[model samples]
Target: MAPLEPTQPDCVWRNVAGAGKAECKIWQFPTRVSRCTDATNVTGFTWALTQTWQPPEGQVYKLNFDAAIFANLLASVVGVIIRNDRGQVMAALSLKGGVVQDSDEAEVVACWKALEFAIDAGFSDLIVEGDNATVMKSIASGQTDLSRLGNIYDDIHCLARGLRYMEFNSICRSANGVAHSLARYAKHLDEDIVWLEDSPPPALEALLAVSRLRLNEELEFTEL
Candidate 1:
């Protein structure tokens, strides 16, 4: 079969309540895979939603962060999880904060908080991943941001200087489910929560789900 194409344009404009028009991009990925056998065997295919969390490089730690906006409550929640190269959880945090203007602000705040959490935990070399493309791009740009959230970006850049090594990565939401789940789980919390060498109950299921999907993908690739 031929490869799939995007159903929408690369960029679209949408009107926001107080922000006027905003530019956004939609990303699409294949949800199925097909494997064809040789003439001696019957052809078959299988379909499943696959997502995986990549491990960090040698001696480096991976930090995944996400934010959940609670518009009704006029607040936002941030979740951060750190893991070593062996995929062992080193630390995790779920924090609740004041209202954010939009998802973009909330995402930036989450990234800032995640960096702070990692620094406080004595992690010097790190790979930070988040599902917000815009926020990630801004952080990775290594240039001054003149936008409203420039201060936060400045703080993040300042924080990065203290680290021996740091990288910013943007991943799809499916791959960031653990942090997403933890952020959502913070809806019932009144203060910041932190766990060392462990994860909260809400994130355990998501962590396991991601592990299974990754294993299945590896097995399929090996078979192919």
Candidate 2:
């Protein structure tokens, strides 16, 4: 009987023998290890927190909208970005909206503004997307909302009727990055800003990032 020894740098072997029978077992440690020195370092290695925005099919337009609440300023900002099947920006809006009590209300108001903007810009076929799942669900439900934000919902539905085609979709915050950027940028503005067939400076980077991601995905798919 001898003491067990490590056969490899990260593994140890054990043996037992009795009555001419022998058995051996080995335990191995993880081949690789990682340590987070701080919160910033830990977050740097985190998986992507968002998904890439997808283009609409056929002639439909994809509209991504988001809201940023400024409680201290007693106001909220709504951002909307519309793109065509080829991911070309058809329109974008960063509007300063009225005060809302919470994020949910703000989101509803953003949706309303987004639809209104789209209709005004003469977009008929739309696939509206937002990161707020509850708001998106309520809008897609097609039921008369009796909640406090019901009036806003009514306005949204009314505007939706003006469109030849309309859809409400919920996406992750990362997927709606362009709109989110616009909403935040609205905080520095005194009035609403609209861009037709282009995006504002603040949203340009995010829009390009999404475009690049879309291009990469397409290339990968093509390669496959």
Candidate 3:
């Protein structure tokens, strides 16, 4: 048999024509070095970590809320869930919010609706929670909101004043999971829905584990 010849520029086929004529060449690859900045540059900056939902102390009730916007549907949806110090659902709302400009607007609408829901439920001592940090910060700081969302902000502020004790806070998305799910579910609804002392089955299932843990904590406290 004949020795093989090189087929492609980078590859070689040996023993094609004859043993002595066989051409076998080794290929060398260049070493590649990537220079990265000092580890301190990346590790130096730190951000405050977010926390999950916790039942409010005393007789306060927490309203965890979120919104979802569907551009194709030209609509927005809001979810508001009120839970007591025991972390059990007291009331929940799913509203088919009208058309909104953007996510900020959607969240603002959700915030307003949350206050409305709380007030309608006769909840005076309440903590309003959402995942939009900017909106929450604006409300918490009592900054003079001037954006389009300012209208909703004003409504929420006025309504909040009616409560004896109220606070606006932002939680991480992990803590707002149930509200997120409910808002996403509302995207399919054409009309608003409200449940008193009840929540959507799906959201209830999602909150079950958390509620159980809270219940265990309460039992421990009782024993103490």
Strongest candidate by lDDT: 1
**Per-residue alpha-carbon lDDT of candidate 3 for residues 46-134, written as tens digits (9 for 90 to 100):** 11123346877788888899998876778889888898887778988887888888888889888888888888888877767777766
Worst 10 residues of 2 by lDDT: 12-21
Ranking by TM-score: 1, 2, 3
What lDDT does candidate 2 reach at residue 191?
A: 95
Please tell me which model should have the higher TM-score, number 2 or number 3.
2
User: Model 1, which residues run further than 4 Å from truth?
Assistant: 1-51
Stretches of candidate 3 exceeding 4 Å from the true structure: 1-50, 212-224
Compared with the true structure, what per-residue lDDT tens digits does model 2 show for residues 1-224? 33332221111111112111111122222123211122223111111223468788898898999998875677999888999998888999888888889999999999988888898899887778887756766675566889999999888877776677666655557789999999999988899999998657888899789888888988999999
Worst 10 residues of 3 by lDDT: 8-17
Q: Which lDDT tens digits does candidate 1 get at residues 70-132?
A: 757789999999999878899999888778999999999999999999999998888788877
Each prediction's Cα RMSD?
10.8, 19.2, 23.0
lDDT (Cα atoms) of all candidates against the true structure: 0.73, 0.71, 0.67
Provide TM-scores for the models: 0.78, 0.75, 0.71
Worst 10 residues of 1 by lDDT: 8-17
Please report the TM-score between candidate 1 and the true structure.
0.78
